[model samples]
Target: MVMNKALLAAVALATTMIIMMARPSVQESVYITNHLTKRVLIVHCRSTDTDLGAHAVAVGASFHWNFRENIFGGTFFWCKLAVEDKRIYFLAYDEYVETFGTWFVCDDGVYGTPASRPAFLKAAWTRP
Candidate 1:
């Protein structure tokens, strides 16, 4: 009986670990843009050694296309954070990208700024 219990416990533990590892991680960053409202919100996670950053970590994310009577457009997204540490947020319009281009962003704070790549950071928000 003792040996049976031990084996069962081990199996249960292994199953739990496998399930946990199989789950998709949270997004290291997220960006949202309202077509009708023309409002944009970018949330970036920390990539450095510090986790105190107020941004959301982009372990996973999604982007969707929105259409309305007056507005029709699609959002851009990074979805995944390469560094898996630092995240930055920004708010701007589509024209911001045309003006700045890819080299516009200098740091996390500059990521979504007027000079940043606005087209690449648009992401869809998932409802809880």
Candidate 2:
């Protein structure tokens, strides 16, 4: 009976581990930084299923949020960015590729950066 109990406990532990591993990340995070010079960068993000709301990031500061993904499929987040009169859009996250972490940013802090980089990041935020 003791041997049987040990065996059952081992099985339960193995099954719990498997379930935990198989499940998608319960909490994932994304970060956005404002590389714009002396400008308050405006960031608004959303998924097909969720609206992450808008944020105003001070220069040299970073904005971030956390959430779970739809592990089944089509898990992605997109963002809208603006500085002064110029505004653009970009992809903040793609679960399939895990394209970036703390993205939509540059240390350069130059205007018209988006024009050169395919708007927002293409493969990044600012999708076509």
| Best-matching candidate per lDDT | 2
RMSD of each: 16.7, 8.0
Residues 12-48, model 1: lDDT tens digits: 9998878766654422222332121222323333222
Query: Which regions of candidate 1 are displaced past 4 Å?
Result: 1-3, 30-128
lDDT per residue (tens digit) for residues 2-88 in model 2: 578889999999988887679867688777777665678878999998997888899788888888877556788888886766667
Model 1, residue 62: distance off in Å is 20
lDDT of each: 0.32, 0.68
Model 2 lDDT on a 0 to 1 scale: 0.68
Model 2 residue 117 distance off true place after TM-score fit, in angstroms: 17
TM-score of each: 0.22, 0.63
Alpha-carbon runs more than 4 Å astray in model 2: 1-21, 104-128
